[model samples]
Target: MRVLFTSTRGAGHFYPLVPLIDACAARGDDVLVVAPSALEPVLAARKQPYRIGGEPPREAMDAIRARAMSLAPDDGVSVMVAEGFGRLCTAAMLPVVEEVCRDWRPDLVLHETFEFSSVVAAERHGIPHARVAVSAGGFTAQADPLVGPVLDAYGSGIAERLLASPYLTRLPVSMDPSPYDVTHRYHEEPRSAVLPDWWNGAKEPLVHLTLGSEAGALPTAAGLYRGLVEAVGALPVRVLLTTGRHLGPRDLGPQPPHVHVESWVPQEDVLRGASLVVCHGGSGTVYGALAAGVPLVCVPLFADQPANARLVTAAGAGAAVVPANAGGEEPTVLDPDDVRSLGTAVERVLAAPSFRERARALADEMRATPSAAELVGALYG
Candidate 1:
């Protein structure tokens, strides 16, 4: 079988697609990843086959850079990166994605949910396409009223354009509803990804901390790293902190012996054996933990994170901390104290065992769904 795999512009969105791509390729099926030029090195390094598509706009890049870090976003600073950029990327990629799909004659189109244009391409070709939702927080398009109006408007004709299936199973990792559930829970195993080098098995209980792929990759992510270093100072647990691609050790300040900071780490590699996760409630980070049955100490930054955080808290997988120093009914800075409090929450989940038990149950439920590759076969065949 031949499959055309496409992901959103960022690493977080692209990384989740890797497991399925490799799975299909390993089974003697050809898989092609169509992405951006900037992301080419990322794909090459992973040894994943890919063709570069659109260049994600410098304006879009600058827009992301200009944005401030906060526990929440304002009305204008939506998670979807604004219509102009989406439209531009879609327009740019349509010809190339279509060309690759035509040349590959793919049996199915496996694409991240964010790109409606991919759906359009598949629809135009009358092919089946599966939505691999990269983050659970982005699921609000199906529900949230504030976002309902626009998503409903732009998303109106997707069903006709592409055959929809909850098939491309996202990894069931994170703080809230597992990634499998994000795609409607149709898989049979929790998907896994390649690990980074820093993840070594050690006797000390490992704690994984990250802000996320894009937002965490920010220059200011150092602030959170410093906070984590201070918060976990002298704690018994060993810490693995990924600062994302954009930042470095100097940005993170001096790291304590207990905390090991890096530009990146194989999250799943660490999460699999870790005791707890401290993170911004980005769906990738949150679900990554959940897939491993590790409880979360979540601080949601924006978008669907709050919803996922709610799910995590409700499911007894972990606790939610809104930065205790936040005032005037809402907060701007994510308080370090709240993250420190999260240690207590982690202890509760670790010591009680019930939280971990419940989390593992969720993972089992998540694993009952079919793998993304199998779904592609079913949907396209």
Candidate 2:
């Protein structure tokens, strides 16, 4: 069987499908990935063969951003889907996906949840399709406003038609807050393990800090990074901070002796030995920490991050501080002045053994879920 995986260019959007791709290949099934040209380097690094799906026009992207900038903080996720990534990316990818599906004749069209274009293509070609949820719980509740606009753009009822597809969730019910009520497949943490050279034998607690690739690209991110640096400075733990490919050393001014900053690092390797994580509440990082039995200090920036952070706190594995925007509607970016507040939260997690214990319990639950290989077999059988 030929399995076609489609994704938007962001690391958070594309990375979740990696393990399943590897699993399919190991089972002697053909696998192909479709993403934008910007993700060429990332896909190449993984040695995953892929085809280039062109990006949205510049005007469309600019419009999306403008719409997001005008939204209230509480409406960020809804607007993001209604005006930004969901509609625009789907429009951009539809042509490429349709063309690829026609030529490839894939038996299954698998995609990350946000890529609605893949759903359209699967329907156009009469192929089975499934959605892989990138976050702990599917963000369907937050996407309610998005359905109408997205469907209207393509055609009436397009959104409902697409959402009817099967869903694969990485998180178990114990961790998921708004779990999707559909045909669901569960899998353990899908990241492959690694050991990087940076793992020195340090007795101090290891804290890994990152905002993931997409979150780091936002204009508000520089301030967030500075705040994180300040927070880490106040702690005694040894921190390995990764500034995604979008930023460099110049972006971050000074750092304390305990903090080490790099453009990027092997996340799986770093999470393997990390005692705690300070992150922007991206799904990949949240699940990665849980899989490694590490607690978290989540400072949520826009999109579904606030929702994911809430779930972490609800599960007893982490603490969250939702930054409020001027609109006073809800939380948005991490205020740089909240550095000390963030530091206090980190210290609390460090002092509390319960957080770590909860994380370990969730880790065991994740381990008990079916493996990606098993899911692949069942999907094709």
Best by lDDT: 2
**How many residue pairs clash per model?**
19, 0
Cα error, residue 243 of model 1, in Å, equals: 1.6
Worst 10 residues of 1 by lDDT: 325-334
lDDT (C-alpha, whole model) for all candidates: 0.64, 0.77
Candidate 1, residue 133: the lDDT equals: 65
- Per-prediction TM-score: 0.80, 0.90
Across 71-130, the per-residue lDDT of candidate 1 in tens digits comes to: 244332353434422445666677888787666777778787565456667766767777
Name the lDDT value of residue 76 in candidate 1. Answer: 26
In terms of lDDT, the poorest run of 10 residues in model 2 is 324-333
Error of 2 at 148 (Å): 4.4
